[model samples]
Target: MPAPTLRLPSGDTWTRAEYEALPDDLPVRVGVVYGELVVKPRPRPIQRRVARRLATRLEDAAPVGWQVDADVDVLLDDDEVEPVELAPDVVVYSSDHDPYERPISADLVTLVVEVVSPFSRRVRPSLYAEAGIRHYWRVETDQTAPAFAIYSYELDDATGLYVATGVHHDRIAVTLPFELDIELKGVREPRRRRRAGR
Candidate 1:
C-alpha cells in the first residue's frame, strides 16, 4: 500500500506560517532554514531516551531565570521570508517565554543540544552559532562502556563558528551555559546494578 500524501503549500520558499500549517499526521520531523524545507525522520526510541533524560539533568541544574526543555521549536532568525527555524534536541532559554508562542525567538536561547545519529551527525552547528547561541552540545551513542559521549562547544563571535570545549564520556562538567556536573550513567543512561556484592 502506498503511504498517504499530504499537500504542501507551493512556492519557491516557505514561510513560518506554511511550516506551521503542515498536516498533524505527517510521520517525519520538519523544519526550515533560509526558507528551505528540511525534513528528518522521527527520533528512534534510544534517541528519545537520551534526549529526554539529558534534558532532565540539565533542567535540575538550570539557574533561577533559565528554563530547559526537550524538542522545542526555536526560531533562529526572524527573516520573514527566510527565517531559520530549528528545534534542538534540548534547549536552555529564558524563563520569560510566552506560553502561546510556538517558535521561541533565537535571542532567548543560550544553549542548544543535539543527539548524534547516522543521518544526524552534521545537522546544524553553524546555524546555531550564526544565531548567537553561545553553548552547544552534541550527544553521541557509545556501543560499550559509558554508553554515550557528549561533545560540548562554545561559539566564537569573531569567527561565527563553534570551538570544541570538552568531550565527556562518563560525566559532563561545564560552566558556560550553567554550572552542571551530571553523571552519564543513571542520569543520561541507565546504571547497571551489580549481580552481587563486589
Candidate 2:
C-alpha cells in the first residue's frame, strides 16, 4: 500500500503558533525559514556526540556573563511577523537573556554552531549569515573515521554573507566572542553491538 499523503495548510507562510501545533511525534526536526516550514531528519548518533562535545568545550571556556546552550530556538528576524527560527546545534548568547520566555533574538546571539548533517550542509550557513549573526562555525565529520573538521565563518556586513575565517582539522583555537582552544579527537563514531554468537 502507498503511504498516506499528508496535507499542509495552503500558504507560503506560517505563524510560530501554527508551527508549534505540529504533531510532536513527527520523526523529523521542523522549523520556519523565510516564513516557510522546513523539515529535516533528526541528527544521527555521531552528529549528536560531536555537538555535545563542542557545546561542553564552549560552555567551559565561556567567560562570565556568557552562556552556551545546545538546541535552542533563535528568532532570526524579530521585525517579521512570521520570523525565521533556527535551532542551531549550539548557540552562544548573553547570560541575561531568557531563551524560554521568548525566542532569543539574532542580535543577542554572539555565535552559532552547526554540526553539519547531510541535510544542513548547504542551507544552514546561508541562513545564519542572512540573519546577520556575527560568528558561525560548521563542524564536518568523516563517516568512515572519527576525524572531524571545523569551518569558521564571519559575517561580511557589506555583502550580508559569511566569509571563511579558518578551517581546523584536529583542533580548534580561536579568540572571537571569547578565547578558547578545543581538541576534536574525542568525537567518534559509535560502536556496533555484537550478535549473540560469532
Compare the candidates by lDDT and give the number of the best one.
1
lDDT values for all models: 0.82, 0.80
Clashing pairs in 1: none
The residue-by-residue lDDT of candidate 2 on 1-198, one tens digit each, is 454333575466776666655664555677788677788678878778888888999999999988988888788865454768878999999878975655788878889998887657867888788778999998887566355788898988899998899999877899997899987776544547898985
Q: Over the stretch 1-198, how does candidate 1's per-residue lDDT look in tens digits?
A: 556475665778887678767665567777888988888778867778899988998899998999888888898888877878888889899988974677888888999889876545675888888889899888887466354688999988889899999999888988888898988886455657888777
Name the lDDT of candidate 2. Answer: 0.80
What is candidate 2's CA lDDT for residue 88?
Answer: 92
Q: Assess candidate 2 and give its TM-score to the true structure.
A: 0.82
lDDT of 1: 0.82
Clashes of 1: 0
| Total backbone collisions for each predicted model | 0, 0
